[model samples]
Every structure is written in C-alpha cells, then in structure tokens.
Target: MHIPARPRQAPIVAGGLPADELAERLRQRLDLPTWPLPLHLLPPGTALVGGAVRDGLLGRLALQPDLDLVVPTGAIHLCRRLATSLGGSCVVLDRTHDIARLVLRGWTIDLARQDGAGLEDDLRRRDYTANAIALPLGGPARLVDPTGGLDDLRTARLVAVSEANLQADPLRLLRGVRLSWELGLELEVTSGEWIRRHAASLVQVAGERVLTELEKLAAVPEGHGGLIWSLEQGLLSGWGADPSASGRLRSFTPEQATACGLAPLERAWALPLARLAALLPAEALARLHSSRQLQLRSDRLRRWWERLEGRPDLEHLPESRRLELQQELEADLPALLLPLLPAAARGYLTRWRRQDDPLFHPMPPLNGDQLQRELGLAPGRQLGDLLHHLTRERAFGRIPEADPAGRAVAIDTARAWLGRRRD
Candidate 1:
C-alpha cells in the first residue's frame, strides 16, 4: 500500500483564487466565447478536462487548443453527432472506453466517458496532479480540484496522483520525466521516487507508444537534460540508452544548433535528430520500430559523426573522403554539424544551403550511358569507376559542365586516365 505525503502546513487554498476568478481566467484564455464547438451542443454533464484546462490555467494555451472533455456517457455517439453537425470527421480512439475524437476546422476535440463513478473519480485516476484538474463546461464554469492539481501547479511541481495510477499505465513513468522538462517544472520527491522505482516497466509499453514519447521529449528545448535524467534514473536503459552516450547528448542543444547557423525550420528537425542520434544508435531505433527513413538518417548521422571524431579538421581529410561525407549527408548536413565548432559548422551550412553547390549536392558530370557512347566504354566495373571519378572531379570543380566543349575535355581526361591504367 502506498501513502501520499501529508502537507507540512495546513492545506493551501486551491489555485490561490476563488472558483469564479479561476473560471473567468480559464474562459478568457481558452477563448470560450469563440469556441467552434458550441457549448450548448455538449451533453449536460460534460466537463472540460486534461491538457486543455491545464494549459489554459498556465496561460500557455495555443491559438487552436485541443479540447479534452469528460462526459457522463455516450462520448463516442456525441463525437459522431458533432462530426455530422459540424461537417467534420470522427476518429474512434478507444471503442471499449467510449473515447472518440472530432476534428473540425483545425480543432481537435476528444470526448471520453467518465471513468470510475463520476467526474471526480476520473480526475483522481489521472497520472499527474497537474493534469488531474478539471473545469465544468456547463453553466458557470466551476473549477474542480479533487486531487490538489491546482496546488501542484501553483508550486510548479509535478506530483503523481497516486502510485497505483502510474502503475495502471507504465508509460506514465516516462511521461513524468518528459513533462518535468517540457513544462519547466520540478518533480516532487515522492513522484520522482515512484518514477525511478518503476523505470524498468516502461519497456512493457508498445514500441510505437515509447517512440512517441521519446520524440516529444527530444523536440523540447531542454530535451537533452530530460534524456540525461531519464538515463540516470535507468528509465531508458532497457531501450538501448547508454550512459556513455550521455556526454554527447548533454551538448546537443538548441543554442548549439543555432550557433552553427541553423535556421528556425532547420533547427526544428535538426536538433531533434542530433539529440536522438547522440543517445540511440540506428539499431536501437530499429528495435523501437521507427521508420526505415528515420533509421537511415540516424545511421548516416552517427556513422559520419564517429568518422569525424578521429579527424577533427574536416579540411584535413582527403578530398575523396570529404566528398563522400558531403554526398552521403547532403540533406542532413546541419544535423551532423551540431557537435562541430561553430565557425566550421557555419561554413559548412553556408555551402549546404546552396542547392547547386557541386560538392554538397554531388552529381556525376556525365551519366554512364553518356560515358559509354562518348568513350566507347562497356558497362562494367571500369565504367562505374570512370563515372565515380568524373563525379569527384565535378564536385571539386575540376570538370566543366556537360556541354560539347566540356565533353571534349572529359574525353581527353578519360583517355589520359585510361592510358595511365594501361601503363
């Protein structure tokens, strides 16, 4: 049996505001007056719950906030009705649990039947105190705080609703770590302990579910720190996170990528790829059932990073080696540059951004068929080798464009090379 910690002092009033004031703030932040889903259309017992209320209270609500509603019953049916009435689509999330989602005009509204006996029971069964709060969406939005979720929010702490609740879904164990870093909150001592205790159980979760959480964590600004903490607590050990890799992940930060001259859109994906590559190898991602493209990206980044580790100066590498690196990582060069010195990384990025840069986007000066017709070369290993040689020369600016004069230059170069091989 697990027992919650008693407050050191008398219980503080929830949210430091009266119910009406809190309700007003939530209503204003969530833009309730302009809601696409008319409140009157909802069931009488429906109450807004989960992240919508949480982010609204924090004043971090997005322009198009996702709404999570708890209903007394018939949530799926209500979702179908909403989809039909609003000219939208309905996706059944869980048929057995009576959970469904309605997507209308860029808004996602999830409706779920209240678990246990009532709304309060459903809130209490949630994983974290900060997420367990609710607000009745019917007449006069009264704040509901059955688990001191507001108080936890006030203190900027993440506390589990209960050990049993976390055990009910072991993914919550990892979710605690992600939420702590993503929301800039500290983990309460007891909740931290509970998460650490059940760290190993996270592997029991579905691979896709685990990958989703990891991707979310990796996308945040403080994701590297969160990953390190997860590693220290042994939460990621089962999924192929090595303690030795922590040093690499620690330096994978948005500021670092920015210093390397990665633009906002580039950093959005590059930083996450760098962080994931730092922490997990390609095989680990494969085990997580990640996409083949993602696995290839990670593998290329990791292999190149390792290759560069032995040769600190990129310019010092042989021309062919440097060309090979550029050829393999043309699209993802920014991700590979995360760990390099800022000056060097900036130089590389400037060239990489130029789509027509021959070295960055390497292409052979002449196709194999063209080479065969021009040089009377048969289709064999020698032909392939000659084509590779031409691409290298083109990438290095030694070969001209494939025009009549340039073809004459290429044929001359090819004949000279063939004569040398014969010698």
Candidate 2:
C-alpha cells in the first residue's frame, strides 16, 4: 500500500488555482489508494498515469473504490492478472476495441492501454473534459490531466474532449444531454450545437441501448425538463411512434414529468383495477408493458367505462342515485361520477348512500335458484325473463317481501301474464 507523491501540476482550469497549488491541496484531502504503479507492464519510456490524482486535483475526495488505470502497453493481460490477484473476474468486453472490465471486491475497474501510443493521446480521444483526466497510481497518486476537467467542473460547464471526439460514437450526443442534466451542469455551446445537429442520429443506435440511456435519463430528478429539451431537439420523436395509435404519447412539461415516471403507475395503484381504468384508454392500456396486477386493473377500468357509458340515464345523477344504478347495473363506477350524473341517477345514488349498502351491493332477495326450487321451472331464457320482470317490479316497490316464497309468487304471476300474450 505504498503511496506515490502528488504531481506538481493540476489539470483543471477553474477555481483560479494553479496546477501545483491545486495538486498540493488535492493530495491532502483526497482518499487515494496507496497501491504502487505496476510499471512492469508499461512499454519502454511510458510513464505511469493516475485517475485518483486527477480527482484530488479537483479539490474533492476520491471516494470511488475502483480505479481506472491507463498504461502504454499490455492492458489486456494486466487486467487479467489484476482480476486473478484480487480474486475477482476479468472480462474482455471488446477485444477489437481493446476494452476490458475487471471486477474486484464488488467494484468494477476499467483498464485500457493508452491509444495513440501514449497517455496524452488516449486522453485526447475521450468524450468529455471531466472524464479525459487520469491519475498516476503510486504512494500518493499523482494527477495527470491533459484536459482542464477540474476547470470545467468548477464552471459547471460540460465541454467535449475534442471536436472529433464525438464522431467516435454517435451515442455520445445523447450522453452529453444525460450527463449535463444529471450533473446539473449546462452544456457548452459548441457541444450543445453538435448534439442538436446530430439529434436524429440517435435512431441509428440499438433500441435496447437507446432505452438504457433513456431509462437513466428518466431517473434523474430533473429528467423531465431534460426530456422535454430532448424532445424539442427531436431526440424522442426520432425513436419512432408508439405501436398503438392511442395518441397517449405527448410532450411532458418540466413540472409534469419527473423521476417519478420511473415507477410504472400501475405498480403504485392500491386498486389497480380502478386506477388503471381511470388513467389510460383501452388501446393505450393494451400496449403497456405491465405486470398481472396492472392487466387486471386495465380490465376493471374497461368494464367500468363500459358500464358508465352504457347507462346514459345514470349520467348527471346524484351520488346516491349513481351508486344505486351502479349496484343495479352490477358495475363499479367511480365515486367521482356522482356529481356528473343526471338528477334521477343522482337521487338513486343518494338513496343507496343513505342506506348501509355495500360498495358492491348483494343481489336481490331471489335468483334463478329460488325460481327452480319453488316453481319447478327448468333453466332457460324464461328464468332470466322472469327475473328481469321481478327486478323491474321490485324497483317500483311492487314487490316488498324478502322471503323466497314472495319472489316465487311474483315470478308465477309474471309468467301467467306473459303466457296470455299471443305475440
């Protein structure tokens, strides 16, 4: 764990601090690792580089557990060996690209051989000033910043590493916005112009990759504002339209959208069935990627909408009337509909509300079973017809007995009357 001395020069340009002065202050405050540089893996004349030192130079503690180290040679093998020594796993994510990830103690360390044959060349190829700086790993870890990342940090500006840097990966356009929003930093004018110019190119990237970035963006606290900006820049519309033409897709105001969007609304519903129905249209609902709970909610909403729409008489009704009709219809209409329902519907709902009726009231006193038992009628359309007649009669106070015998008598009398009709 022998540490190296801090470098004399800082890499950042902000805070009006000179390189050497910043370096000294960084060394005192940063919690840098004391691991020695593995110079044995370096090529001839290649000096060691540091990531911790750069973090320290920025006047912040290097609390990051894993280190990102760059060497002029043998990065692949070095990563493998480091993983083995540390009792972790080493993976060559892209051999052609010379990129590898080493996992040690639940931390992932990225190792890359300096491209362009040196550390400076490698730093020149990064995407941002903040990420372009490195630190030499030694007793105190020296900062090796080719880009003024610390200066950019202080100014709260996001600057590209170089003009040609973004061409390396078009996805960097999206990354720029995401990072800017996440860090609460304004994008440099040039970088923002480039992003706006190439906004449509985001479509060329894979869907999953694009979604991954979007998910991250959506999770940011001020993500809604950023997303709105992205939309204005045409980043989202280029992704393609939603599969269903439900027209649910629309721009979100900064205040309307937030990181809260990360939680699927269906998952948060206590009465998912009702909440889902209340929130989304049927076609839009079908297109949602949701759990079983949400699906049930969608179904319930659909049914409720159907019941409410079908019963025009219930509209503009009082709460009591709406509730009564809802009970009569055997449908679950939202309580909010009470005020919107018609006067008659409202009166019915009011009457029901005054009584101790359950949200889902029980069926009337008699059903088909009582008919079959008392009248010896077979199960057929007649039973249904008779029940309808009895229901109508009961609604008007024609039938008042709660006993099954009273209901049977009513059913027999209705059947006799209907039997007398020739038509």
Candidate 3:
C-alpha cells in the first residue's frame, strides 16, 4: 500500500534520457524468459536497494558489478514470489530480519523489507551515508538520496548517517571500518570519533557477526592496511583481543609477513589455503565455538604454533616429519608465523610441495585397525598407542608403506617398548 514518490516536474528529459530509462534498460538486458511475470505481478513501491543500487551507481561511475538488492517490503514473500515467477528458488535466510536471498543469472541479490520507516527513516538508521542512498524500482530510476549519501559517495568520504547511528548498533562501529576499506573511502573525522568512542561495545555483538565483517575486509585485495588501521584504533582490543599482542602482530607489513607465513610448498601447490590462513590469527578460530570442525582446526593450528617456537625436540626429524611440522606450524600461528619463518624452512617447503591437492593432499596410509589385525593386538588403548608410534615413524619416513606388513612391524616395536616399560 506504499506510494512511491512521483517526480515534481515532467520527467526530466535531458539528452533523451528520462526516469524510466534505466528500468527499461534493465528489463531489456534481462534475458531470463520469466522476468516478465514478476515485472507484471509485483505490487508498486517495492524498491531493490543494496547491490542493485550499488551496481547502478557504480555503473554511472564506470565501476564493475558487486550486485546486491534490497526490497523494502514483503522481502521474504517477494523473494519467493520472484523465484516462482522466474523458475528459481527462494532462500529464506533470516525470518526475524525478514531477509531472503536469491541468485539470478549468477548474480546475488539480497531482499529485505523497508519496514514501515519509509526511505528517509531507513536512510537515517543505516550505518553510513554511502550505503544510505537508494534507487527507485522503476522508470528513470531516479535515486532517492534523503541523507545526501550521493554527495558523500562522490566525495569518497565515510560519514555516519547520524550521531546516534553507531550508538543504536555498536556493531556499526566495525561496519564503518569495513565499509571504509571495502569502498576505498576515507573515514571522516566525526565518523572516526564515533567509532573510537563506541568501539568497546563491539564485544557485545556476536563473534560470528564481527568475524564476518573481518572476513569481508580480509577478502579485499588491498584492504590489509585498512584492517591494520582498525586494529590501531583499538577496535580489536575493544572486542576483547589483547591489544598489545595484536599491535605487535600488526606492525609488520602484510607482504613481509606473507613471505614467511606461506610455506614454499603452499606457495606452489596450495596457494589459496596459504593465503587464507596468512591473514588471520588463531584467536579468530576460537570465535567459531559452535563448530566442532572449526575447533579441531583451531586445535591443530595451536599445536602448529607450539612447533614453530621449537618447543618439542623436532630437530633430528626427516623431511616428511619436517613437512608435518610445517603444516601444523602454519595452522596455529599463521598471523604470527607470517613474519617469523626462517629462510631454511621457506626453502624446505619449496622442495616438499604436494602434487595432487593444495589444501590437503592425501590421507596417511596406516591406521589402528591395520595395526591390530597385523600384530595380534586387541582393539584397546594398546592399539591407539601403537598407531601413535606408527604415525611418528611415518612422520620420520621410517614406515615405507601403510600395508599390513609395515603395520605389523610398527606394532611389534610398540609392544616391545611397552614390555620394557613394564619391567
């Protein structure tokens, strides 16, 4: 029942361009045969904000697609309706937030209701001015800039929507930093002050939410420095991180750290995994407490961190043992290791690159079952002890194969060691 704002004067027709031109252009460019159904069935006043506006404005500025869309009302219902109309699927993400998402022609569009606030109210409530702008759903596609968001976008400045904006949602403090990096915009003084004042409240927000924003910033090709800027502003400390440790970690250039952090083997074979772990601290892994798999990954990373400092006696280890050590080392202290790897370790990694897969190559050949069957051992703690011994042997390249014959010898050695200990 919402009524869209009508242009005050006759649709501005300059250079043969009018208000509906962009919508018409979008309709024409949409090759999907079923687009007409929603175009015809959709009720009026439902605007696609977010990515659609982002891309449209970027297009006006000759930028590429980072498409996102926001539908002001009936967002979830409209997503379902659009999906059915287009023969696609509607994914209801958050019923509470009234958000739904869809993928059309490989472009991601997020749908959300404008609530009852109307455009001006909604813009005022948002985190930043650049994101406060909206483009109309149809016709000349005139932009709705109730908060002068367009001016801030043009100026490449990060300005909060209002003074109360960050206070309303403390997470907005981190979001401001994220948007500044993502859009390559510099934060205005007031916005920076707002973030500094309210940064401590970020801990109250969910860790997953904070981590998501951090991940997005990390994904930016040139946003590392911006992330460093956030850390320098006490944002990480405010979120419960040990500020001194984080500061010390952030002092090195990301490039300098990347050199030591990425194993030569990972550089050649598992570049993506190496790059991913290189930017993060193991501490972030603790934030994902809900995931058992992540916890295990974090534990493995912690063990690796222990190895890098040469805590356990691993000096006399063989190449395979060295490789396993390196894997664990990279996992635990990726952020710390980035700037501290020795030249010898870097060179050794190059010679050990796995051929088939980068992230994980292949499973080890031996296990407890094989050892128990081969060595006539019961399936108990003895079998576990034997497996550990065999793993160490495999790590040192002593176990030639993972077959029954090799497993039998490994178990025999373990039993002898146990017998000697019993004496």
Q: Which window of 10 residues has the lowest lDDT sum in candidate 1? A: 1-10
Please report, in order, the local distance difference test score of every candidate based on alpha carbons: 0.83, 0.55, 0.55
Residue 395 of model 1 has an lDDT of 85
List the pairs of residues colliding in candidate 1: none
Q: For candidate 3, lDDT tens digit of each residue in 349-411?
A: 343444322212322345666655555667887666555555655555565554577556666
Question: Which numbered prediction scores highest in TM-score against the true structure?
Answer: 1
Q: What would the per-residue lDDT of candidate 2 be over residues 247-321, giving only the tens digit for each residue?
A: 111222222222212123311221222322333344433343334544454455455545555454554555555
- Angstrom error of the Cα, residue 320, model 1: value is 2.4
TM per candidate comes to: 0.91, 0.53, 0.69
Clashes of each: 0, 32, 13
Kindly indicate the candidate among 1 and 3 with the higher TM-score: 1
What RMSD, rounded to one decimal, does every model reach? 5.7, 12.4, 8.1
Superposed by TM-score, candidate 3 places the C-alpha of residue 293 at a distance from the truth, in angstroms, of: 3.1
TM-score of candidate 1 to 2 decimals: 0.91
